[model samples]
Target: MRDKLTTIGFDADDTLWHNERFFQLTQAYFAELLADHADHDHLMERLLAAEKRNIQHYGYGIKGFTLSMIETAIEVTEDRVPARVIRQLVEAGQEMLAHPIELLPHAREAIEAVAETHKVLLITKGDLIDQERKLAQSGLGELFDGVEIVSEKTAATYAEIFDQYGDGPDASMMIGNSMRSDVVAPIEAGCWGVHVPHGLVWEVEQAEVPTSNPRFRELKDLGDLSALIDQIS
Candidate 1:
């Protein structure tokens, strides 16, 4: 299987480096910032709703998330959210954009090992600027043969990407944390999907594990990827 694969796509955010954890931390701060306006639980509900609603409009990443936070605050406070709170929200987003890139354990090692014999690509959907910034800071940019910052991850999108890269679905593999984007979509596109569990996943990215799919694989971490490929090969 490994020998048959000519290209491997890796999801950038939580798969290669820390991402959702920062969002989780920022959410905690947001909850505290609006504690006086609404209860934590209610505020969280509103935030989730806002994100889902704004996803199509703003797409994914920090800018959209920051906008959703502001929208949620306004709604939760009945349009009475303070200017200070808004400023704080903007600052939180800026901080996230400037956050250091911390690669997950064995991420570089795994990528390097795989790249030695495969064409590795970074496939991530997010605000273009922020994603590029993280990739630059991650210091692993050179490891990938190509980088794609897409608007969304879907079966059609995966198929298009594979075609553009000159690799058929049967010769492509996608590895990531999101079952919806990384596993199901790619598998649906006829590519192999490998799920590497991450501790913190955004609610919108969540989906049930596809254990029934023959092309779907769940690994404990990126560290196991090489072995899995070898075994399958």
Candidate 2:
């Protein structure tokens, strides 16, 4: 696999840094705010539904999550969600936007190791400004051969990026925490898809493992990524 691979794509959120935890924290605050209007479990259910519905409209990131929280509040409160609550949600979102980036374990080491021999790419899908901010804060921007902040992660997206940045999908690989976006989609594009499980993953990002796929792989953490590449090579 090493001889066949020329490019490696890494997911931004969760895979490289702390992401879903912040969203979960914000959501807990949201649940507290709506405690009077809706039960905790019910509120969470509605919010997840709203997020799934709004992805097409808002895309992904803090903005969409904030909007979904507001929508869920309004719906649960029979359209009587308080103005204060709305303001608080907006402030919460602003805080999220300004939040600091925290790198995950071995993120830097893994990227540095692979960049030494392969065309390493930071390929992720999210709001442009936020993703750039995180990357800047990460201080690993210069290590990547390229960075692709896309609107979505699909087979087509992987194919286009790999072709542009490396030898193409058959000679590429993608690394991330999400089964749906990182592992499955890239594998579908003829790239190796490596899944490195994270402590907290967004529900929408979860997918059934493609156990039947020869290119599908799982690692406990990014620390083992370099070794996996070497072994496969």
What does candidate 1's lDDT look like per residue over 60-96, in tens digits? 9999999999999999888999999999999999999
Question: Model 2 over residues 104-132: C-alpha lDDT tens digits?
Answer: 99999999999888889999898999999
Clashes of each: 1, 0
Model 2 CA lDDT for position 70: 92
lDDT of each: 0.91, 0.92
Name the lDDT of candidate 2.
0.92
| Candidate number achieving the greatest TM-score relative to the actual structure | 2
Can you give the TM-score per candidate against the true fold? Answer: 0.97, 0.97
- Candidate 1's C-alpha runs over 4 A off are 1-3
Candidate 1, after superposition: displacement of residue 229 in Å? 1.2
Worst-scoring 10-residue span by lDDT in model 2 = 1-10
lDDT of 1 at 8: 89
What TM-score, to 2 decimals, does candidate 1 have? 0.97
Model 2 stretches with alpha carbons more than 4 Å out: 1-3
